[model samples]
Target chain A: MIRGKVVGRYWATKRIEHIPSGAFLEVESAGGARMVAFDVLGCGEGEDVLIVTGSTAASWLGGGKIPIDALIIGSLDETGKSKSK
Target chain B: MIRGKVVGRYWATKRIEHIPSGAFLEVESAGGARMVAFDVLGCGEGEDVLIVTGSTAASWLGGGKIPIDALIIGSLDETGKSKSK
Candidate 1:
């Protein structure tokens, strides 16, 4: 898992239906590199997060297929530890 | 998927049996970053490959559990295009 900060939201007015609603976010890694990830966890801006990427992300919806390539698996508290189930 | 070069091999004489045999390799991304990835495809050193990560990787064995966090899913040819199914 990569530790990153929730930098902002992604507004895609038109997108594939395979993607679940409210599934986009922009995360900036500790190294300052940013990438868009699907928000499985409802994280707010400035919150630290754990990012799970690749096919693992696409499989989160179980047998159903989704285009998500990265996913926010966990939210981190101020102490940089995961705070949610 | 992230494209990376198979820089080397990882030898762990003692490992969990849940992880398939001959499943570890070292991959270096285009940005010069390196990480260990499980080799689903038989990739050799110097080959460029595609990586899949997260829980998706752990789920590749159907319902069976594995400790893999990253997986090499495809191998690229000399022209920088995927050469394997």
Candidate 2:
């Protein structure tokens, strides 16, 4: 899983139902990977987050196929930014 | 799937019971889905990660959507950082 933050959101009103949900986001990691994220979990702009990708994405969606490549699994607090751990 | 990192995390005392979970992370990928992912696998600062987006994210997860799409499936060691891949 990649670690990054939700930079912004992108939305397409006329998208397929099983295609993908929520707004699109930009996540940049310290590892040098900048990825786009799907479904910002109420994630505000400039919030760091985690992301998932690949076949693991199509494992078992509600009897339907989302066709999307990523999903927002959670939200992180300010604990990690401390740099004191 | 988009590539990124767990820039930060979130911990909600009370959520929608099924909207989203874990700490939200930011990830950058070659595919260009700056996405927030779910289920980050013990990722840390400056770690590059892979992300899955859309309905592709909700396959099983005990059988639910957790809403706010995006999931982090795996972790990358230090090999990808060489910037030579």
Candidate 3:
């Protein structure tokens, strides 16, 4: 997982149905590249987060297939500690 | 999943044990970024492949937590079609 800050949010009108509502988040990679992530955790803008990419993304939600490729698995606290941990 | 070309192979002697031997691959993303992947499929250098990144990287090995964060799940054919498809 890579550490990044949530830069923005995403609202897709026509998207795959498997994704939960208000699940997309925009995060900037530590190296400055930005990508969309599925927000399994409720992360606000400017919040530091850890993103899980690849097929494990969908599997994190349990079994069955999902159309998601990235997921915000954890949010970071102010001290750079993981809030979920 | 993303499309990439296998640029090289990796052999880590002092790495995590969950990953299989001869599993590390150097893949160049379509956008030109290079990253390492776990080779579930035996992919040769110069082969086109589909990579699954993130936590699902470890999950693709079935159950049990693994240390991998990327996986080469499929090898593409010369026709630009996926060989496993």
TM-score of each: 0.51, 0.47, 0.50
Q: What's the CA error at residue A51 for candidate 1, in Å?
A: 0.7
Angstrom error of the Cα, residue A76, model 3: value is 1.7
Q: Output DockQ, candidate 1.
A: 0.07
In CAPRI terms, model 1 is classed as: incorrect
**What digit string (tens of lDDT, one per residue) describes model 3 on residues A1-85?**
5556789887888766676554688898656789998874567899766565666665555537567767665554444211212
| Candidate 1 lDDT (Cα, 0 to 1) | 0.64
Model 3 per-residue lDDT tens digits across residues B1-85: 9888877554433222344454556676677666656676788878889887666667666644354567787887678553333
| lDDT of candidate 1 over A11-30, digit per residue (tens) | 88777777776558898875
Tens-place lDDT per residue, model 2, A2-80, is: 4566766666777666764456787766455667767535777877555555544343234346675655545555554
Q: What is the interface RMSD of each candidate, in Å?
A: 11.3, 7.0, 11.5
Candidate 2 local accuracy as lDDT?
0.55
User: What TM-score does the A-chain of candidate 3 achieve?
Assistant: 0.81
In the order shown, the candidates' DockQ scores are 0.07, 0.15, 0.08
TM-score of 1: 0.51
Question: Whose lDDT is higher: candidate 2's or candidate 3's?
Answer: 3
